[model samples]
Every structure is written in C-alpha cells, then in structure tokens.
Target: MSLRKKIADSEAVLNWVARRIAGYARRVYRNTKWQRVGFEELDRLADAGEPVVVVLWHQRLVMSPFLYPLDKGRICTITSAARAGSMVGRVQHLLGMDTIAMSSHKRHVALSREVLAMTKQGVSIGIAADGPRGPERVLSTVPLIWARTTGKRVFCMTYSVKHGREASSWDRMLLPRVWGNEGVFLCKEWPHQVPRKATEEQTEELRLSLEVAMNDLTAEADRMVGRAPWEPRAK
Candidate 1:
C-alpha cells in the first residue's frame, strides 16, 4: 500500500475517514453490480419483526453497512471502544445503524443484557464473529452465547468483490475499487445457533459448526463472483 493510503487509514485521520466512510461505502456499493444469492429467507426476518443475529467476518467490514435496508428495519452492531472502533461506530451511524460500543477485553454481562434488550425490541444485531482481536476466521463464542441466551437465530453473511485488493491485515480485508467490476457476491441464508440447554461440549460443537458454515458460505460467495474459493484460515 502507498504511504498516502496508510496515512489515510491511520488513527490520525480516523475522524476524516469516519466522516467519509459511509459515503465511500455507498459509492462502492453503487459502483459494483452486487449479486445476491440465496438471501430470500434471510430477508424475510425483517431485522425488525423477527430480530436475529447476523454473523459476519471482520475482513468484509467495508460494505457491511448495506447488508440490510436503510429505510426499513432497525439494525444494530457492536464496535470496540477503542479509537478506531469509534470510527467504525461513526460510519455505522452515518449509514443509519444503532451501535453498542464496548471494550473487547471487558465485554461482559452488561453487553449481553443490552443486546438482549435490543433483540426484544426487534433490532437485528450484526456481529463480526472473529473480531476486535482474531485468530483470523476462528469463530468466537460470543455470538454463540448470544444466540443461546437471547433465543435468537444466528445467520451467517458474507460478500466478495470481483475487483478489489486484499489488505495485508491479519484478516485480509478486501478494499474495493471505485469504478466497477464483473460483480460482487452476497448471501445470508444460513441460520445456525447453539441451543440454550447446550452443554460445554455441545456448545463447542455448535461453535465449530457455525464457523465452518460461515467459511462455506463465504467460499460459495467467492465462487459466484468468479473468484476461486480462497482459504479461510483459522489461525
């Protein structure tokens, strides 16, 4: 990446980045011919009438703001309390999302309570399953715990761009070009969760299941967009 790009992405320019992030995101969204594959059932949830938890990878955060409708359903997402996270929350706000800001290290019962309340109010929540800190694509148990505690279904969503640069970040973030490409691929039909009465072992089993499901979903999206199904590293 160029020094100019790195500087623009740095925390020093975070405020500037945050201000334009949503617009850039929308611009990218418009520029790409997005192909939605098998999102019909997921779309029925309304994100307002039947709130659910949407699990996404941290790497694809850029275009995530457009995953749900802007004028209809209520959508909420969590972000870290760190400086960079503030930018993320701001971007979501600019895209008309409600945010819960929490420190990754200390996210606890309080966060769960807030999420539960939001779910009850029909606000669909989006969680980056491997985020804040990550062993790249290694699924965190937080979303599983939320599913069990809130009695909400968990849905896996992913997208891939046919024209984009893969960032050198740990998660290999995709940076899309401004003009256009063959297409973008997206899907959110897979619904999974850990049961409320799940034992520790059962929870672990469910966690791995959801993790693989997300990886599989992402691979399918990539294939649809004309990209080889890339490896989703758990490391």
Candidate 2:
C-alpha cells in the first residue's frame, strides 16, 4: 500500500474511534441530573403555527437536542462536518431529529430555502448560533441572517447545570447532570422591513439587540440555577 493510502486509513480509524467516545459521552452525560424551563413558549410557538428558529450558544449544543419537543416533527438542526458534529448528528438521529450539515466558509443557499419551507410547513428549526465551532458564549449573526431571510422568530436558548463538568473547549462545552435544572429563554424576533440599501449602523443595532436579548436569557438561566450573571461556572 502507498504511504498516502495508509495515512488515509489511519485517519479514518481515528475518526471512528473519536466518534464512539463522543457518542458514549453524550449518553452518559444526559443520564445524569437534568431539568428544563421555558418549554411552554416553545410548545406555544409550535401550536400557533409559528415555526421557530431556536438559537443557542455552542456550549449548550448537546442539551438543545434533549430540550426540544419530542412529538413535533419537521425540525432541523444546523451542525457541521467536524468530528464532534458527526457525533452529535448520530445522537440526534437516535432521538429522531432531522439535521442539516452546514459549512462555516460557504453559506448554503439551501439552508435558508429549507428553513422557509419548513416554517411554512409548521416545522421548527434550530441553529446553534455560537456553534459548528465557537468563541464560547458569544453570539453570531447566523440567527439574525436566517430570521431576515425566513421571516421567522429566533428563540434564544441557553442552559446551565448546578453541577457538572465544563470542557475547556472553545464553547466551554457543558455536560449537565440529569438531575440538573436547565432553562430556555425565548428572544422572539419580529424583523422590520429594511431598505435594499440598509445601512451598516442599522445592521449593527439589530445584532446588538439580539446579543442583549440572548445574554439576558443566559443570565436568567444562571439565576434559575442560582449563579451570578453571565458566569456559567460549574458549581
């Protein structure tokens, strides 16, 4: 066998092993202590024929799947081609979730198109605003971009555990105990009409509004779990 083929084979094996470890981790992590809040709004949104776009921080990506309504179908999650994402996609499939793998470099024209279609069909969509990779709890413009494109409200979601391990990864990845309490806050977006020549200032202001709303939701979740504002330290 050529050296390149051998290296490719080895890479494939390594990726497979990594995926197994992540899948195991996800199952074990969820079996611990877990609690949920603000789901009523989620169900209500679904009830009102308002297909929503759930925007959450990257750290809480795993928890997002479990927090979603089980009976509802037509839901889509935006993930990536990363190894961790591959693991997540597997778990989501097990839980009956439909996912769409997205690229950070190239925006998929189909993503917006599919989201609009799903919304029209009364299916919900979720975007890990700070994900596919991330800078911890920071917000991204993807959620806003989708909202502007699809004409749907963006539900800003966040969660924290009273006790658990916080991965040192970019998103400070959270592994909440099954007995831990989790909270979801909705930052509903009702986009205004923007001129074809919308100013950068206007765009920045909208983004800032989203950031503030999401941050407040995170803070509220912190309070629910009895912590200081914006401090997701695992106590």
Candidate 3:
C-alpha cells in the first residue's frame, strides 16, 4: 500500500511487458530459412556426455538461441547486473538458458567458478567472446580459460543472414530479417589447450587463435548465405 511499493510493482509490470515484446520480435525476425553446418559434431559430443564452451562473437548473439537444440542440455551464460542484463537474462531463460550476473569490467573469478561448476555437471556454457561491451569480434580469453579449467572443448559457432539489418551499436549487432536465408557454421574444436599454469603470453596466443578461427567461421557462414564478410568500421 506504500507509494514506493506501488511504484516497484508498476516497474516490474513494465519490465515484463518490455521483455515480452523483445521476445516476440526475436521470434518474428528469426523465423527464417536456416541451414546448419557442423551440427552433427555438436550432437555427437553431446551424446558422448562431453562438456563444451560455446563461443561466438557478440554481434551474432541475435540468432544464437536458435543455433543449438534445447534438448542437448542447459547452457549457462553471464550477464551484468544492469537493467538491460536483466532483460537479456529473462529472454535467455525463455530460450531455455541459465544466466549468471557478473560485470565484465571487474574480476571474473566468481563467474568462472560458477561456469566451471556448470561444465563439470555436463552443462555447456555459452559465451559472447567480445561481449557485455565489445570492440566487436575481438577475442576474449574467458572461453579458453573455461575450457582449460573444466577439461572441455571450445566450440566456435557463427551465423549470417542473407537479408538483415545491422544496429549501429558498439558491436554492430545483427538483426535478422524474417523469411531470409540464414547460415550457421560451427568450427571444429580448438586443438590447443591451455595448461593450468598457462603463461600470459600463452593465453594471449590462444586468444589470437580463437579470434582467427571464429572470424573465419563467421566469414564462411556469410558466404554460405551469399553475403560478404562483415567489415568493422574504422575507429
């Protein structure tokens, strides 16, 4: 009955409405003709009860929920504590994913711990390598670190649409066009592994390798959809 309580209730209702609208938009946009490359490999790994760290660029987040089969198992991803993060978490939940709230700007020890635990339980973790904020497509070493720590493989995947719009955000976020042709490419697992005592230089090397592999897969996906590779604008 208090004024503050009433305002909080109204805000909660508004947030729920916003999330519903966003989810509806996603469903509409992603109702496309989809082609998958390398999904059988993912299926094989999952059938063998192997954990994986699913890695993708931040810009490609739009279509990611549709890339994997929900029957595989639960996927855990990290989000921030911001309002936007909350909305994203809700959207992901609707897509059958679990989210951990953590800021990318700070130390990720807790996030790593939780993700590692999830992987140990045979639950795959999905990460937007250059996300939360991005220099778009630049690789982050978090996925590699999780793979090393959990003894899991890193599966790099990316997708492109034949017809879509790109948001002018920091990541040039891809917005799919309904009924367009969409192509998804999944790369083979990274061959190299980071040891528990991996040096900073070694970690950097792994990061660079991941970046190249992800970019190559993304480019191939674009080509499959008859689109050119995405070129980032000059800073």
Q: Highest lDDT: give the candidate number.
A: 1
lDDT-superior candidate, 1 or 3: 1
Measured against the true structure, the TM-scores of the candidates, in listed sequence, are 0.87, 0.74, 0.85
Best by TM-score: 1
- How much lDDT does each candidate structure score? 0.79, 0.65, 0.75
lDDT (0-100) at residue 90 of candidate 3?
62
What tens-digit string does per-residue lDDT give for candidate 1 at 28-107? 88888877666566677774388878888988888887776545578898888876677878898888889999875665
lDDT of 2: 0.65
Runs in model 2 with CA error above 4 Å? 1-35, 104-107, 178-198, 228-235
lDDT of 2 at 85: 76
Per-residue error at 126 for model 1, in Å?
A: 0.6
> What value of lDDT does candidate 3 attain over all alpha carbons?
0.75
Candidates 2 and 3 compared by lDDT, better number: 3
Candidate with the larger TM-score of 1 and 3: 1
Residue lDDT tens for model 3, 1-235: 9987676457576477657756764764467666677778787777776768888888887666666556866677776666656556667776677888777555677766777778778788788898777778888777777778787777888778788888888998877776644545455566677788889998898899989989888888888888867886877
